[model samples]
Target: MAGRRRWSTEEILDAAAELLRTSDADSFSVRKLAAALGTDSSSLYRHFRSKTELLRAVADRILLAAMDDYSPEGDWKQRITSLALHVREAFGQQPQLASVWGRHASSGTGSRLVMEEVLQALSASGLPDEDIPARYHRIAVLLAALITSEARVSTVTPEEYEQGMELFRVAVLGADPERFPALSRFAREVRPLGVDRRAAFEEILAAQLAHIEDAVHPD
Candidate 1:
């Protein structure tokens, strides 16, 4: 007789998510998840038809988690900023998932809802009807890039991170004063901030928000 199903769908998903959080998301596989759950690979296939489907479900779960306690009550810029920050924090908590977000392409209900909220905010931002699509695309791509890059950095080893910082310091501090005046002049101030990813992300996000504000109200 067939053995009683040992794992519920929710149980399987929870274990899969934990695995993704604690390991390399890009290398996630059904067999590995099954092993982690103390089951055979075929057992996992009984719940999810394939690894791709499982990944989609996991990605959607992350998306929905990002929307927890999210409030849609605010001006356009406020709305976008809140959503962006919430999403970033959610991914920061699960850097492995964020690292593989682009590869998954999850367009499930959660993904659709997020897109809807952002698009609505963009429409309400006072941009011309024709420009809204392009602006939305730009914002989405930039946000994805920023979060993915942060996740990648979080996964690196101490040695690799130190090496990266050293390379950055060399490039910044070695810039010639005559040709690269600004970098040379601010090298003292900038070199120390090289490892401050949160600060860098905030600066970039602020600049993007300012540019969007300019587009809407060019005064």
Candidate 2:
């Protein structure tokens, strides 16, 4: 029976994550997952206790994938930018799973590890030690928010996407031009430049870090 039966935590979480990729979390029930896994609901309880725990495991697995073998050496800005882009891609690849990630309180080991690595990278940028946590938190929150927001509007038709981008350009440029003069002047340049979202995110992050540095030690 041992040879014939096989249900590991990784397998279960992978299956659950795959389901989340295509369906809403509300629609993903333990019974349905067990049925799909060729096991009974009771069997799942042996591994995961509750549906919430199983979902947390699924989120952890996906988050780990986003952090696959990331290296910390080389340019700090580039590394962070790549990390953010990978995270964004991970979410885009699995919108439903991403939504679950954003909604959860982030109690999983994988999630915490990712945050630690991000904090370390930000700290290496020479910002105040006290500011690292808040800076890291801001970057993480922004990345997650942007990814979720994009996922929600991603169902637009190609033509509609183009039209929306055009409209966004006009709105950003026209709104409060006096206060956001630089943003207004660069609105058109911004859209096309985001083709490499990793670069864009990195640039934004670097700017934030620079701002923090200036605030802490102004010349």
Candidate 3:
């Protein structure tokens, strides 16, 4: 009789995800995952052909978690903003997962579902059907980029991170006052305004979506 398989595919993938959450993606090797699960690497092969396939499954699971059942009702701007924020928060929770989501190209079912919901929401927002695909693509890219950038910043303590931002402000604003007068003035006015990354990202996303909306329906 064959020996019993000790771990299910879900158990293996869940272990891999836990590793991703606590460690960097580079550390997520099949050997490491198997070891963590108290199994040999060969056992993992029965469920996943290779580490790449396992990573893909992990990415799909993460992407599904990132999606929420967004309501199409409400001021379209608020609805869109809520959706963007939801994606941001979800990605923030799993920075490594965001990186995987950023490169997913296989038209996986979860990804397809996300795209469909986004397109549907855009369509309901009075955006032209023809423009939905490109708009959805842009929004996804922007949200992913913003979330990943914020996640990097979040790796540091709030106090240290604030000091770093202050340094960045000085560097950027000090470049040329005449050229960047508005930025200089704003920096002075908000001197050391703690990095509210979530708020900043929401504002940027809102503006971008507004632009897209205007383009599609041009006043």
Query: Ten-residue segment with the worst summed lDDT in candidate 2?
Result: 192-201
Q: What overall lDDT, based on C-alpha atoms, would model 2 receive against the true structure? A: 0.74
> Please, what are the lDDT tens digits per residue for candidate 2 over residues 132-165?
8888788778777776666656534689878877
Q: Model 2: which residue pairs collide? A: none
In model 1, which range of ten residues has the least summed lDDT? 190-199
Residue 27 in candidate 3, Cα distance off native in Å: 2.8
> Model 1, range 104-212, lDDT digits (tens) per residue?
6577777887899988998888888899888888888888899888888887789987998888889999989999999999987884433778778778877887898
lDDT of 1 at 71: 82
Candidate 3 clashing pairs, residues 3+ apart or interchain:
none
Q: Tens digits of per-residue lDDT for model 3 on 1-219? A: 977458988888789888877766566689999888877899899998877778778877765676644454576667667767666667777776666566543245666666766777787878767878888889878876787677766656678977888798777667576887877767555644336776788788988888977886788
Q: Which stretches in model 3 have alpha-carbon errors above 4 Å?
A: 1-4, 68-72, 104-107, 157-194
On TM-score, the candidate that comes out on top is 1
